[model samples]
Target: MVFEEGRIKQWLINYINPGMAFNDIKSVVTHYTALHPTKETYIFNDGTPMELVNLQGTIPVTYKSVVYNIPIIIWLMDTHPQHAPLCYVKPTPTMNIKVSKYVDQNGKIYLPYLHEWAQDKSELLGLVQVMIVTFSEQPPVFAKVKPKEALYHPSINNSFPNSVFMQQPPYPTHSPYPQPSYQGMMPQAAQSGYPPGGYPLYPTPYPAYPPQPSSMINTGTGTIKEEHIKESLLTAIEEKLMRRMKEEFQQNQAELDTLKRTQDELKQGSLKLQVVLERLEKEKSDLDKNITVLKDKEQELDKAIERLSNQESMDVDDAVITTAPLYKQLLNAFAEEAALEDAIYYMGEALRSGVIDLEVFLRQVRTLSRKQFMLRALMQKCRQKAGLTVV
Candidate 1:
């Protein structure tokens, strides 16, 4: 919206005094308008209207007599109800005032009086008119405030007072106590009994009237007065306390929700760890059973070798070997079994012949045999599963 004098003044007042009433300023004018044939007129205020000098033709109005020359003239146009008034200012020769010209270090014309003239009220008014013309040449700054229906519905135009168009209502003033209510549409004032718009005729119900003393006047009498306590401040404090409590409750609830989520995550992690531990224990048990079966096979092979050592010849009869197929089967089961036994026998003979240390040879033979036997058994299982018989 285009800035009006009233709006500008209000902004200035707000800048100067935050809470003071701006309407008390008598010199400040609003919606000021002037025309050419009438010269200059202060239509709204009771002050004397200023005289206007007509420039024979268009000329520029300068601060002093002149550094530059131009023309000034004013144009009049009818004002529309929904639109701001239209005016124009064209430059004229007579309006220009020439001053002593001076150039600084830079080649620029300097006119002291011309600068002062630009600030003059008459010159400012002319500038405002020029701005209006310039703006009209371009697009409108704002859409019309009134709707199209207002134009067709004549009653809508008169529904609100003219003051509503010029001035905005004061923002709802906050009060410590609840605003007093009346039976009908009109708002009731407080104990002051003054209605809106500065009217004081309305009667309002008083919530805390002073109590009368019972004692009457006798030959001599005394009067006593009681003080009434105001509860407005207390009410305001209570409202603030309630608001703070509500905010604290919401913060606490958010913390509780976050804690609950963290707890649920920890529970899920614990359950996953439990499942992993159970699977690891089962795998450890299966490995132990395989180790026990290997130990039993090794013990049976040791007994058979001891019996062969006691015989007069190293070879056993085929009939005697055939009577126990289990022994023969076990011997032929793993491909590396004969090599493992031969290594063990050679280590034992070397210790007996003093070629190696007895304790060292026995330890090496036991370790080598255990590892080779386990590996050979694994290889035999793989060969059998692939349908290849041992040679």
Candidate 2:
């Protein structure tokens, strides 16, 4: 697919915030796309689907002074900078994956750079560089061996599509020791399984081993020594033991990683509990202080109640005693006015029941009203003299 740089930028600008994160993404995308174009898609993992930008291409790696191209795919998640990108070794059909400590059986690449990815420090470009360097030390894939005829016959090897060769690397690139080629059968060098111009140029470092004589194959049992058989058995046992040890080591490493993550979670939980405990302690202290204050206030109220209960009630005359003569006269006048009002009210009730003569009742009411009015006037005068408010 043609790489649409504009479309990719537009998508990023629309989705990512315009900040350090955006700039970091733009810089990496721009730099990487110079060598290879990008592809966009929505990808789903164990989690929810996300729109991702992926670069599927080869990066150059120099191994033993010979430059080789390693085919790989880098997936940039939507939450870039915050999280590291996913890297995978993309091998062709003829290429079988070579698993190492850095590259898993699934062709998923793992690196210290990826594991320790920091938003402030890490970049996508650096990650690609790391992958290149790591793969150069140990290539992640090797070309699958063809049939003996294809390997030995030049004409048969050339019959395969050149385009297929262009995509895949040559056979047995994972072997630390040099591969033994048959120069006697095929003279001219061509794509073992890879391209002519070296999409990944894997040159054989050692010359082909001489073919074994037919006479040796017929006398194999006679030539085979007891020591050689024992040695072969020991070598096989050692290899099996080594393989089992490696598997156990990988499993233990995974468990250790899980334990580390669990430890971190426990640390966070402990901090939260500490904070809660501190807040609870503060609340408890405040409650204790409040209880002390309430107890003190309760003691004061009880003392006031006890004092009032123990004291004798004052006599009416002593309670109503005034310091000034005008206050005393006002008090006496008020009492007389209230008594006369009651007497007048009772006389009116008696007249209504025909118990008193109308003439006597009217005379008594008139006298009582005159006396009440005089007493009220005297009370007002006395209050005014005493500097009190009169109603």
Local accuracy by lDDT, each model: 0.37, 0.61
Candidate 2 overall lDDT versus native: 0.61
Model 2 / residue 166 / CA error / Å: 17
lDDT of 1 at 71: 23
TM-score of 1: 0.25
For every candidate in turn, the CA RMSD to the true structure comes to 29.3, 15.1
Candidate 2 lDDT over residue span 1-391, tens digit each: 3455567676566344425444554565566643443434433433334445556566676666766556676666666767776777766555666655666555667677876677889987788878778877877766554555334543223444323322321121122111222111111124223354223332322122112111111132434345654565576466556655765676689789999999999999999999999999999999999999999999999999999799898676776668877777888899899999999999999999999999999999999999999999998888888878978
Residue 380 in candidate 2, Cα distance off native in Å: 37
Give a tens-digit lDDT track for model 1, residues 10-86: 43332333122122111111222221121122121233232221111222222222212122222111111111221
lDDT of 1: 0.37
TM-score of each: 0.25, 0.41
